[model samples]
Target: MRPAAGKTATLFKDTPLALDGGAMLSPVTVGYETYGTLNGARSNAILICHALTGDQYVASDHPITGKPGWWERIVGPGKLIDTDRYFVICSNVLGSCLGTTGPWEENPATGKPWGTDFPVITIRDMVRVQAALLDHLNVESLMAVIGGSMGGMQVLEWIATYPDRLHAAVMLATAARHTAQNIAFHEVGRQAIMADPNWQDGRYYDTGARPEKGLAVARMTAHITYLSEDALTAKFGRNLQGREAVSFGFDADFQVESYLRHQGSTFVDRFDANSYLYVTRALDYLDIAGRHGGRLSDAFKGASHVRCCVISFTSDWLYPTIENKRIVHALNAAGVPVSFAEIEAAHGHDSFLLDVPEMDHMLKGFIAAAARTRGLTGGTGA
Candidate 1:
């Protein structure tokens, strides 16, 4: 479905901003939706950053897929995000295709789609554009910045780049830097996209030749990381798809194979393959600590005004609990007020996007506590 005429007003209001990566982007737009009221002071603002492949439709139904927003379970009128109590804003990141500046956007210079011309973007570049958007909205500071996965990386960047701009931060199931193994997975996805003949070197716009197979394979590979081995085993195991026994053929004889195929096919419908390449590359290039002399604590140094909460899921093997622990240790060493929790869940890395009772409770408590500390409500002095 196409977006309404005014649906993307805020996102597309501004023109493309040049990036530090030496790329000129035009007609750059961000797709976002806001919830609740900003209040008289505008101090009740909460920014929600989305993970890779996630768009700005956090609480509302998605425009493209017609499915409920990715985090609708946790971000609604009375949900954990509590739109009734705070103004919440979520936007598609710079390198995304969901109404954001990306490979799919029209290039003014050549009067064509950017495609491969869309220069490589870093996570920091994404944050820079987000800051510009917030500035355009006249939001001088934020009550809290919350995110998971790549979203979590942006949350860290916000605090590090704009230390005095946020009152609190909540990062869930994320890491400070991309590991070599993570980069390898991303490389595999990129290779899959490039290997497809239909990709046509990223210029298949008018050829009606989309790299669907390649994009699907890439999505399938990445989806596996979002799930745990145990979860996969329990869900599919050695079961066959609708057959009592294996077909003994190369087709999707296994239940797991069928499930992954479904995932890939549906993903390509809503996501652009080139955008996938750009966003995944951005994730691979993220390194918060590296910008701070390789000391994670240094990243938080002098940011005493911001309180932080780090959460990890036990089954999340992608980011893992140890990753969250390291972030907590760094925050503690920086003398920053922080809280850490390891919630027990069976959903693996994607648990943060799913419904987990303990996670909801923790978020409610953390946001409430952080708000009080920041003097958003009447409680102990912030």
Candidate 2:
């Protein structure tokens, strides 16, 4: 069960997908990467799910950005994830741009980009595809499943859909469902994309025009949510970018504006506009409770074998501590062993992506405990 020396393919030819909406998806593919060695018992497997705008390059360099993998700080040989002791596997979620099937992929039927034709997916569907990929990899069970943000949604879905398949779970900075406000913000981004004339009804490929402006605006809007008011104020509040005074024109007169603009511009180069629409739509549609008769506890009722750790940040208004508490409460009622932590941090939803010493300590301890309970060795400290 060890990973090969070089990159390998996990997708099969013309895979069939049974959609929740009763539609059929032919020729499905998933992009993924594996690191470390699975022991003879195959009991050391860990799955890492990525958030929105994240790819499968968990410990390697990003092919497009030419930067270190997004989670390299927390993963690798001796990092928090400890690839030396755990066989870690990460996959680009279904409906993503990085080598997974999405709007950017060509539609076999029309021989054009799927674009608007791409079927709307749910978190459950994404997990389903991941489960299939795991099957392809010959992994019968997982030691743990860990993720944050949209990745966290996948983590929750993993536990619900395959309760007995994983020994433990780690969910960070996420929610069981999208709130009305969350949907509203995602709609704003979708509107921005559609408003761009270059979008061309989502058939922009033939036109050779990219909705860079609109997509950048969308990225700017979402990036704001990834930070806290305090962070924004501390980083750039009323400050001008290389200018002593604010410009009277509508151009970026403030440092914050300039920073956001840069973020948006850089994002478009590596991301596809239509993929943003599809992935955000999946996030908006995520609701494990709604699918389980409006009770969050019911979703985990059968997941008694799972030991879970739920982490939240103090300043994360988007999927705040209260939301995570609700999840913990549900796990408690379901009689699942769980640990809940609301760490003190000023970084908001992005804290999980940053190097928070407290979070690192908590995760190291929790993961070690979970591994010990599952009869694995080589435990690390808090």
Candidate 3:
């Protein structure tokens, strides 16, 4: 039952989706992409959740940027989450601007973009939407759910909300809840966007204007958090930007500054400022433990039968190994079969997206091991 390659599933059309903020959202559209076949038993499905800025293009070309999908290296015909033997699914999550219901989308009530009016969404809400997407596709269960960073938050939510819907989960560089530093960084980004006069309280869509400067600054700031000091040193260091000496001006004097400015400029081209605010706020509000009486273990009460593999990088202070350990501890308290790995890498929080041989090998081995247990074929992953 391999569905069409690109499809968007509509849900909450008749029944409004109950949000954590007590507001109901109707006519939620989920944009998604599928690869390979669902297999005879419908037991070969693998859901790949994307990070904050990612969309539905997992193993294909991005429509907006015309660049290869973010995870093309790890997800393809022979990649780690190989599309050859597994049916792969990836969706643009709610509160995201990429072909999904988000702040930039129109609100039926006011006939304008939701903007700041969009109800605050949480990780659980995002997971619920994905579950609905699967239901609409008639997929009862998934062989494995995989993600990293914010995507990993959704993976953890899946374990809490629909334990029986998936057999295994691979969580990388994430935590069960948002740390103070996480919220702080997100708040800074939000402040930067809101400070721009062009933002106009997120109502610039009609005026044909955008908060490009603010959004670019926000992206520049957040991009720093995604990397490590060691990686930064190795990549750029104190190298001057196309000059032998200092500029003695505000221009990019160092190569790192130039690179960051380039990153900021390019990011604003494909992302919406309002959507950035909503998504970051959603991530900051992710507190599975607080939702379950402040006990992280309580969130996994019904996930005893689920298998989990948690991985973290040594240089990833944004979502450090300590955070992953806390999750492993909670899963252990819940008697869930879980494996944890701490890879030594200098790429920081973004290590999972880079070409780290150890991560590639680990994912290939872990996916293969899970596939074997589920009676699925296995082959070498890229």
Each prediction's Cα lDDT score? 0.84, 0.86, 0.89
Backbone clashes counted, model 1: 0
Position 302, candidate 2: lDDT: 81
Give the Cα RMSD of candidate 2: 3.2
RMSD of 3: 3.0
Candidate 3: tens digits of C-alpha lDDT, residues 222-311: 999999999999999999999999989999999999999999999988889988998898899888899889889999999998889999
Task: Kindly give the number of clashing pairs for every candidate.
Answer: 0, 0, 0
Comparing 2 and 3 on TM-score, the stronger one: 3
Q: Which window of 10 residues has the lowest lDDT sum in candidate 2? A: 1-10
Q: How would you encode candidate 1's per-residue C-alpha lDDT over 1-382 as one tens digit per residue? A: 2233113434434465567677655555666778888878878889999999898899888877889888988877776778888889888888787777678877768878888988999887888777877886778889999999999999988878887889999999999888898999989999999999999989977787789999999999999999988889999998999988777789999999999999999998888889899999889888778877899999888777788989999999889999889888888998988889999999899999988898888888888887776567642221
TM-score of model 1 vs. true structure? 0.94
TM-score of each: 0.94, 0.96, 0.97
The C-alpha local distance difference test score for the whole of candidate 2 amounts to: 0.86
- Candidate with top lDDT is 3
Per-candidate Cα RMSD to the true structure, in Å, reads 2.6, 3.2, 3.0
lDDT of 1 at 353: 91
Which of the numbered candidates is closest to the native, going by highest TM-score? 3
- Candidate 2 wrong stretches, greater than 4 Å: 1-15, 379-382
Give the distance in Å from residue 360's predicted Cα in candidate 2 to where it truly belongs: 0.8
